[model samples]
Target: MTTYRDAGVDIDRANEFVEYIKEKVKGSFSQELVTEFGGFASGIEVKGYREPVIFSSTDGVGTKLKVAQELGVHDTVGIDLVAMNVNDVLTTGADPLFFLDYIAVGKIELETLKKVINGIIEGCKMGEVFLAGGETAEMPGFYPEGVYDLAGFCVGICEKGDVITGKEISPGDILVGIRSSGFHSNGFSLIRKVLKDSGVKLTDKIEEFGKSVGEVLLTPTRIYTREVKRLKSQVKVKGLAHITGGGIPENLIRVLPRDVRAVVEKERIPENPVFPWIQQLGGVEEREMFRTFNMGVGMIAVVSEADKERALEILGKDSFLCGYIEKGERSVKVI
Candidate 1:
């Protein structure tokens, strides 16, 4: 007689894993999280909004996970997973309320799962969102041993009138860019290819980055929730873009009105050592590099020229006046 355990899915181990992670998960809870673990559905209180709008986003860390796996580091990927989703909802001018995660692994590894959970908890704390619930699935045949995938779902709320849809964006809006920690979890398909083709090992130390290749590559995606919230409160933000996969041109256009185009001054962007290192190693073109990576700027905000100084004051020294909006076809130009 064949059993589920014989097929490599151990029911007892799954139960034990859930029990182990319960407290760590609870560490992220805010007062809004009403339901606890072992529930069919999690519950959160809808409060504070006279007319509330719900904003949600789901995303994964993409191929960056393969690097983490290669380095035997599983903790920071969880933070990257949460940052991807929370930052998306933040673009809508929402306050992140809760987060849920999905983890699928070939087999349950208690210590590894614990590290991931701790990372998620840290991300939730950084974003000030609740760790409401999540799922952990062990499917032996679906994934190879010692391998897993992570995805996250984030929910946020804003007053209906407060949504930053970019409809208000027009010509003369100054674009301010916030610096990124590093790559922020996109374009790794090309990154891995470049590394492999160049024969750079994960353990290889590069003096420019002041860290090993794996350390730089596995840098966690920055969480922009707090910065964005504070900026919105102080400035009249007409548009917001979270730079990701398609980089500046692709992401900034998402928030521009039809009559306006974004003019980003590439020279104005602050330099980061890792990007130049990647460019040298891969021989990637400037255009391709901007299109593939954040290139130092992680988030961009459109504000009226009159409000630029105040916005910068709120964003502090790391932010830069990257460019402005102009009358034209709906597109972005990196000059």
Candidate 2:
């Protein structure tokens, strides 16, 4: 008489976990979420637009999870999961409507999963996106004990005519950079390699950080949905780029028109101590650092020089005049 539980898949515990999650995250669901938790699929209403364009994005936290898992802190990674997905859809000037997550682990660890879910709920509230639903998978052999992975899916809606394409970006357009909240879920493979080879411990604290390496590395990614939404309402944003794994040059060029070039004043990107610390510690080159990490600029907005002042005002003190579009080939130059 063999049972699923005997195979390390506890169906009973999974059932209880579902019920526990239902109780924990109900408040985070938005008014537009028509379906309740534990449903096979969730539905959301897209109202307020005569012609609505739906956009979506999916992302994960990458290897940053290793640091979180090693530190026994499961909450912040969930926020990273939401920020990565939500910010992508926001690049298109869309309003994030709903979100779903997938969690896979070797065993059903109640304490760990609870913290992860709570973080997701907090992220949803912060981003104003509804927590529609998600899945929890128990795979014994596939994942090691106490180890898990998370992925998030986001759906956003925008008015069809209002979609922001870089087509409008031309020479003399101003580029505004919104500061990042640390690395924002990219470059962890290099981060880990640097950590291992450079001989830095998570518990170690440097004068600049004022916190342990673990705490700094585990910082939650910033969600720009709110700031972007407000900016678009007033300013004529020609293009927007969400700086992620590829950093500025790679990511920003995607929104550049073929006939122009963007020259980023690298000196303009606010100084973040962690980046300098990593470069000095690992002896990494400046070019590779910009290509791999955000280097403190998380999002960039392209606007006509006329709207530049208004855009900066909306982005507030954290924003800076990072670059300007010019007539040249379709690429970004950070000098």
Taking the tens digit of each residue's C-alpha lDDT, what string does model 2 give over 1-335?
99999999998888888888777666556454665556697666666799999999999999999999999999999899999999989989889988899999999998899999888988888888888888999999999999999999999999998898889899999999999988889999998899899889998987776899999999999999889998999998899999999899999999998899999999888898889988888999999999999999999999999998899888899999999999999999998
Error of 1 at 99 (Å): 0.5
Clashes of each: 0, 0
Cα lDDT tens digits, model 1, 95-176, are 9998899999999988888888888888888888888888999999899998999999999999999999999998888999
| Ten-residue region with minimum lDDT total, candidate 1 | 27-36
Candidate 2 differs from the real structure by a C-alpha RMSD in angstroms, to one decimal, of 1.0
lDDT of 1: 0.90
Against the reference, the lDDT scores of all candidates come to 0.90, 0.90
Which 10-residue span in candidate 2 carries the lowest summed lDDT?
A: 27-36
Q: Alpha carbon lDDT of residue 293, candidate 1?
A: 94
